[model samples]
Target: SFSGPVTDHAASDDCGVAILGAEPDKFWHDHKGAKVNAIRTRTLISKADIIVVRFGEKYRQWNAAFDAGMASALNIPLIVMHLDEHQHALKEVDAAALATTRTPEQVVQILTYVIKGTLPV
Candidate 1:
């Protein structure tokens, strides 16, 4: 499952509209059963060859650490995108091993290159 803070934009969607204003625990319990029964769900995680993480201002350190851990555990390539102001923390992870992008479009471009095996690395 893709876990992240729900944004206002998501709340306007059909599924989100239904879950709007519901308690967090209630939502979790409601979805738990179906989440367990899906076979393709496991494949979703394992089949991801690359994980692109967007690190904005709110949770920079936490998101970066989480992405790093997930990438390491799953053995998938990880690309971290952040503002130029936060470039210093990029060294906290593997500089040469991680792909960096400064914008959302750049993140996509980086992932495309990585998937195509053309990224410098």
Candidate 2:
């Protein structure tokens, strides 16, 4: 979950978040680790209705970019969260986001609007 009070906005019935990456025991520095990472990322992307990407320095990594690409290829609704001003490969992804946000609160609000299909302007 987002760890916020999104209920007030009627977020969604399925408001769950999954963090996909390497475990502490496995780092993404070898061929085996890379394969595992790719498979996990692909599975998560395939299952997600909407994929939220935190754009920053870490997103510059190839695996992170690959995940975004997979989400794009699958035609999932992708939201690019600009956690910081740092440039990342998310911008290179061809899929246009439904919206972009700079803060967690904004992210929740955007998710609410996206899932609900309406926003109280």
Candidate 3:
């Protein structure tokens, strides 16, 4: 999650914001650490209002499924950014609940709009 105050559109002021990312330590660490990190990341995602996931060949693991599940269970918006040339199977995600793209800047813009209440669903 984002670790600082962000501009909240609801109040039109700065509010504590959290940008929830999934299983970072798992993706970068060994098996022993991945399990623990997955749990921690899931916990964070369950508590967040928005979840941003980078989808590509690099994240072909099942962690992405876990993140998607968390977002679905919470009924929060899930933003998937495709950064690579490889096509991914997005069938597990709910089309109505997900926002997908191929750029980091698009993700940032969407997040900013979400925080500012300017995004059109």
Best by TM-score: 2
lDDT of each: 0.56, 0.56, 0.58
When summed lDDT is taken over every stretch of 10 residues in candidate 2, the lowest stretch is 9-18
Instruction: Give a tens-digit lDDT track for model 3, residues 15-37.
Output: 11112322345343344344445
Score candidate 2 by TM-score against the native.
Answer: 0.60
CA error at residue 59 for candidate 1, angstroms: 4.0
Worst 10 residues of 1 by lDDT: 8-17
TM-score of each: 0.51, 0.60, 0.59
> Judged by lDDT, which candidate is best?
3
Q: Where is model 1 more than 4 Å wrong at Cα?
A: 1-45, 94-97, 114-121
On lDDT, the stronger of 1 and 2 is 1
Question: Going through the candidates in order, what is the number of backbone clashes in each?
Answer: 0, 0, 3
Clashing pairs in 1: none
